[model samples]
Target chain A: MKFNHACKLILKNLFLIFILTSGVHGNENVNDKVKKLTLELRCMTCQNQSIYDSDADFSIDIKKLVKQKFHEGKTESEIKKFLVERYGEYILFRPLINFKNLFLWLFPFTILAIVTVFLIFSARKK
Target chain B: MKRIIVISPLIILFIICLFTLFYIIGNKDPNKPPSALLNKNLPSFTSKSLFDNEIILTDNDLRNKKIIINFFASWCTPCKVEHPLFFELAEQYPDLYILGFNHKDAAKDAKNYLKDEGNPYTFVGVDKDGLIALDFGVFGLPETFLINEKGKIVYKYMGPLTDKIIKDEIQPRL
Candidate 1:
């Protein structure tokens, strides 16, 4: 009975914490939130630019979409995922390291390790 | 014959190294044009002044002061971050002329936006048509071109200007 009561109290505390934190941080101005998130997204076509970079008519339209998403109260990650769904993975500036991109993430370090090992082995043999 | 065979590989490797170096340098910044554009006369065009809708600012009028031309749009996010820095820069370089090319925006919207956000520009030009942007080879908004007093393009930054760049990169050139 005591164990069940303790677990209930812990759950209550966690719920209260969630409510307080979300109330404080979640009420950011919709425009500010959207502006902050847009810069983090990459431009689809323009090299090394964010969606917020280009003056293309399409970019302006995307900004309008972002403003709409803000009103929907979606999180930053949710907005990014929605963009990725629409435009594919190419929309992101920093590609997420996942199962599909595992090779890309590991290839650079693997090549560096191979080179170091080859150099050490060649030197020791000599 | 043996010496030639061994040296042949070495010479080929040397050529490959040189080619690789050139390729790396070439691909470093694809947006920046060749050095030929630098020190060339600023392109001439007439654009509606952002400050006054009826008035037009000619390229010839821009010859006297060292100007920093920023391409920005109301929809651009990085332009928001770059906006406050421009205000600080205007404060620092009172004599420095800062002009903005408002690419494809309504004059009333641009003016109202600037008024609300703090107008950092000395003069704003409406590029309702992106012809002016094309002349300068602009691929994106928030790009900055620093022109010398003689209207020669001295420096161009393809991204948002940070405090470090203002202090370390641009102030020295000024």
Candidate 2:
């Protein structure tokens, strides 16, 4: 009877440890997702820092909002679209690829291509 | 060939200089981000009145009238500086509807602030939770939006409402 009691206590301790460890891991996963999403969002109040980096009240509010939306099972794209609709494209650190911003997206590559072609033609001429 | 290359570079330099000059002179206050809601209809929201808890104000109340929506807080110093100007404007334009949104402020503080400063608002709404402010895309306090009779947002001023702003920008539009 004594041996049986000791085994039961040991098993209960192991079960509690396992549950605690698994709960911590689960929380870490959600925290990682929240951090990734917050990093992508600009702090509108600061205008210079990401929502994850800024300590502004507005940034805190935005972080809470992002986490709340995630809790509601919103996809990342859906969350981004919602913020974009409210705050406009200016809220995005990386400007959206669209008709108005097509040139902005393509301009650097276009310039690089032009420079490369010009250099190639010049080398051939030499 | 050498002359063409030299001349072309200089021409390009001059053109770049001209463009930079035009850009700098034409665009004043480059720090001010353009409001996304300009020309868009006001976002609908319902909030309790600051004065009377039973009274709720909505977007419907703002329609069919030339309205000025001012986002303010008791804690913001700029709002205090701009308070007298609002009172002056309120006195001047009795027909104009000015809605005061007490953003992210305590109800007691907001009421006390208004009492101290003299309430110039036609209808004051308390944005206690700031959800309404978020809907309006308000990043900071003391921003003002002018809505037309059609309920379209015509102009948004991001800073304090100075006398010059009232005389030049707002009065002309009104």
DockQ of each: 0.01, 0.36
Residue pairs with backbone atoms closer than 3 Å in model 1 (clashes): none
lDDT of 2 by residue, B1-174 (tens): 965763564466467657757865676654476788889999999989998899999999877999999999999999998889988888888989999999999989998999899999999998988888888888888899999999988888987999999998888877
Error of 2 at A121 (Å): 2.3
lDDT of 1 by residue, B1-174 (tens): 955754554466567657757975866654443333456677787988877769889888887788888999887778888889988888899999999999877777787789879889988898886767656655566788888888888877767889988888678878
Minimal lDDT window, size 10, model 2 chain A? A110-119
Candidate 1 is scored at a TM of 0.55
Off by over 4 Å in 1: A1-126, B1-5, B8-12, B15-19, B22-27, B30-36
| C-alpha lDDT of residue B33 in model 2 | 68
- TM-score of every candidate: 0.55, 0.85
